[model samples]
Target chain A: MIEPIVGRYVTIEVQGVTQRIYFEEAGQGRPILCLHTAGADTRQWRHLMNDSEVTKANRLIAFDMPWHSKSLPPEGFQTQEYLLTTETYIETVLGMVTALGLDRPVLAGCSMGGRIALQLAALHPDKFNGFIAIEASDFQPAWYDIDWFDRPDAHGGEMGAALVSANISPFAPEAERWNTLWMFMQSGPGVFRGDLSFYTRDDSLIARLGQIDTAKTPVHLIVGAYDLTCTPEDAKRTADAIPGATLSVMAEVGHFPMSEHPDGFRPFFIEALGKMPEPAA
Target chain B: MRSTLQTMQARLNASDHLKHLGRLFSETVLIEVDGDEFYLTFEKGAMVSLDAGPSRKTPSRFALRTDADALQKFWQSRPAPGFHDIFGLVKIGRGRIDGDMLLLVKNMRFFKEFMALGRVKAGADQ
Candidate 1:
């Protein structure tokens, strides 16, 4: 059977460079903008976008960042190395929001996306209806060496997939687990390291947590029970720091929750949506 | 432990799990659990040797070394967060790896499947 999702591209200028961003959308009503994890694409949200329960009353939108998937890199990309920073990341998301003319969309992201979600809550809470930061923490020390991710001798595809496979819960369906790994394996050269540059070395957001006014924009922090990278403990610390932030630890799920096991992730997602304050009438 | 490794070797050779992913993976790898060593040799994705070791004569592409407690936790059906993946073990300081990392990374899927056999064998023995 054919799915209801629609794919489209929008041209937006981010960091003084023009980029043609690819995004997929399904369903209708309040907008839910999704941001994929480091080195992954929009495919991570396929299951969520197809769920009738989610789409019937809400719209799900997922976009591939520049240099990832169908979204081609900006001009002069080949000459210089690709490195994502907080400034560039925020501009890209905001550029998309403005280009799409979204009305107070609920911003949701995983891992690197999750980190940016928290960053937005602290810096641009007024732009989103609510925030869902999955597998994120306020301050995560460098985990994997960047050299190991992209280098001359190591095969980027195999190394990236193998390193990430451990984050998948043993309970995740075998097919979905492999599917998640397959996408990681397909990432472009240096893309994984470029994205991780933001995740691992970004300035700490510890002090900024207090600035999030969850009353205006509810903050929901969800983490997988099996995410060794951003342990539930790390997310909890972030949640506690935010005055009204809510935290949920999903069992039998890992870093790639929506992709690795959407069935396990659906209930929690619906619940978070239920908590979203009704948009201004 | 010797018998367990033998059973693991037989299982790896019989399963089609690594069919497409292991064609070029021919290497000898070493595993050291709390100082007790086991040398495993894979020939074109099939286990050819499961040598229990004290001898330093056999060369390997790489070695994964961790304590017995860490191995026990990793072999659990539902391993703890930090022990679930080999990298996770290293990240949490419960494990160490040395030698040709590039070779190991290239044949990572093969090695991961090879290591996961411990979980299955441990469960079966229970």
Candidate 2:
């Protein structure tokens, strides 16, 4: 039985939709907003929440994306067209920041969360102190080509069910399966479709990588040697494109390396966080 | 391949506890597979195999199998949810645990810490 940590739930208005947001705070320093992957909620960071490194130095904030976990899906939420888009995600993040009174929190994201973090950094550079992207890539949009809005549901076809299942963790506990399923349903068919849509699209940050002012803030690219979803090669390319972007790869790890090898991942993450510049003197 | 295995055996034999454990067990094997390479070191006490695969090898009592790609994901995202809640969804390939599930669970923390140190060492060398 996982109990909710010390946190509060509030509503944020984004594009005329009232979205429910849950957040927890720990320690006291520059704020670091930890974003979760696409199919997961803020619960992903539960382990880090208790880490001495996280609790002793930095203020940590983690939340579910719109329509995830405790967050309610907005009316007419469409995944293919709207759920994972840069604009919608950025707006929700901005709204949450405004609601919480956080000033320029450093953003850290994993997989889908990483993509959102990059988009936020690129689109709204004023809102973040720095950005950390874990196993993320600018190549997602090129992986698939399907109209997510028109895609079928779990009951519709095998491909649809498989696609939907792919987003959720295959190693998820048995007890949470039904609850996760319910969350998926509430997220509607559009959410996964939107993810596929976003993943397969070609709008990338590779070309603009050099434009990012890494000297003013730290940008760290951490990857696992065996991540099939976002290959280390992709990470290497992205790192090479960005000026002074440090890349670290852990051996004997995979797509979800943090969970697969938590013992190894923490030190590099801590070192990266330590390198973050203090907020403008 | 056999020479690599011999080298690994020499390395393990050099460890006092492992050498002692080797005398107790009838048969054991220590295999490390990374990419296209495979190395096997057979011992007696406890059979352990660690697979960082782009290659395949025989299974053993305790196996920690992952690849470079997955390692990156794990590093970038620590403390991921769904393991406790969604284990079935994860694919645990190239891994085998032949005995003492309870013992494995008990020593999981130590094993994890050891592996963590191994990763750091590997990173530093690179």
Candidate 3:
């Protein structure tokens, strides 16, 4: 049975500064670290967080990155402009793992988090057990005028979300649509644009795809049919580059699948966990 | 054709959603319906100009192309799939969003609101 969800804050040092990260945990067994999409907090993983069976035997944990959700920036680390680079992002996740003492836990993330999941498995093939990437890819072929995010009178984060909301399947239920919109509206200003820099420009797993040992750290790429930004073909291409990497295209789902269609997306997510080699039995 | 363009421009000027568009400005997009081409230049979230055959001064970061009928359908009520949004139209093969993807993604809301103005005209025409 799934236990009650518990929330906590982990204080870790990044860039010679102390930062507090907000995270939620439930169930207990093999550690499962969940990361959210760009500009989105851990709320996207609500289904997995509350799953009765999945959480029953697995330690499911999700966290908000600094400058996102409740993970506010370090004291006196004042910078009006907030950007997350590949280095900063990976380092923070690694910091969490090290601090929590999770032993090569399975990593699951979507969009920006998905991008990180692929890199973590590749860079330290022995460090992670598996990689679950959703609506993510090695790289995006498009570029945008980022300065637009800094323009006066434009709320870049919210405006960016309106575009992201487009990724939601038109058939999404009203509750799911409102829930997604509420989270998007609550995100910190300019955070979405900052996160996209890492997702869209900074991180690319193409060159390092061969470095991943799928036999050890299996990779599963899941894309939704309605996620036009990162099409199913994109995930297929990324999976093909990595030997043994598996790809699944969900029907009627979109970019933010887990939350937008949690019940519908649960089975596919569970199947991914099923693929993970039993943790060091 | 000119009447449609003028209607779109007028609606853009009156829209509170489009009037205060942030980070989405400083972009000039070329709109091509059939062989008719023109540019919409945005600055600080407001549509500053709608000129003939694109703007030489600002040029166009991206261009959209479709026939007038499709454009009309896009402008009218979005009661069906494939005719709702530009990306939707692109997905169903009715429209194309090409050139400078950054502008397209970063300023997408600006575009969406700009197009959704068609709802007003749809009500008027009916």
Task: Write down the C-alpha DockQ for each prediction.
Answer: 0.56, 0.02, 0.23
Model 2 per-residue lDDT tens digits across residues B1-126 = 334334444455556655453443333223233334332323343324433334334443444333444433332222232121111113334323334433333333223322222222223433
Q: Write the per-residue lDDT of candidate 1 for residues A133-220, one digit (tens) a residue.
A: 9998987777557767787766787788898898899778889999999888898889998998888887668888999999999999
Chain A: TM-score in each model: 0.98, 0.79, 0.94
Model 2, range A170-206, lDDT digits (tens) per residue? 2334344334334334444455555555555636666
lDDT of 3 by residue, A194-213 (tens): 77777777645778888888
Cα lDDT of model 3 by residue, B1-126, tens digit: 666667767888777767776344777788888867888777776677778864356568898887788777766642344555677677778888788866566667677777666554334645
Q: lDDT of all predictions, in order shown?
A: 0.88, 0.56, 0.78
Error in Å for residue A84 of model 3: 1.6
Worst 10 residues of 3 chain A by lDDT: A141-150
State which docking tier applies to candidate 2.
incorrect
What value does DockQ give for candidate 3? 0.23
Candidate 3 or 1, higher DockQ: 1
Steric clash pairs (candidate 1): none
The model with the greater DockQ, 2 or 3, is: 3
TM-score of 1: 0.93
Q: Order of candidates by lDDT, top first?
A: 1, 3, 2
Best by DockQ: 1
Give the C-alpha lDDT of model 2: 0.56
